[model samples]
Target: MPRARVVINREFCKGCALCTYACPRGILVISRDFNSRGYYPVMVTDEEQCAGCGFCAQVCPDVAIAVYRE
Candidate 1:
């Protein structure tokens, strides 16, 4: 299956976890595993559910989320 293009910049992410809350489709979440900064990393659990609304990107104060439309 083709996947929706979504990218998260872990380095730029301050682990605010706002993306997980902003996603209407419940596609984004905070990882149990920590990133380099010891903050829980955010991720997309289901890409197909993503409507490409860019809510995550918009809510991210750190500009950590990027979504690509296919």
Candidate 2:
């Protein structure tokens, strides 16, 4: 069995939350804390739910999300 993970670039994240909506497994969420841009960034609640579908990374306009499966 392999493990899956999702990485988020906080500096580059504008917190539009498009990635959260794009995730099919409901693993992504909007952080309560706002980023420097005053917006809530996307967060991965659980790595285990990730299927490495890359929906988050693909939907991110800022290119701040990366999904990996190992």
Let me know the TM-score candidate 2 reaches against the reference structure. Answer: 0.86
User: Candidate 1, which segments miss by more than 4 Å at Cα?
Assistant: none
lDDT for every model? Answer: 0.82, 0.85
Indicate the residue-level lDDT of 57 in model 2: 95
True-structure Cα RMSD, model 2:
1.7
User: For candidate 2, what is the lDDT?
Assistant: 0.85
Expressed as tens digits, the lDDT of each residue in 1-70 for candidate 1 is 4246679997778778888888888888887887788888788888878778888999999988898876
Q: What would the per-residue lDDT of candidate 2 be over residues 1-70, giving only the tens digit for each residue?
A: 4388889988788888888889998888888888787777878888877889898899899999877887
Backbone collisions counted per model: 0, 0
Best by lDDT: 2
Question: What TM-score goes with each of the models?
Answer: 0.86, 0.86
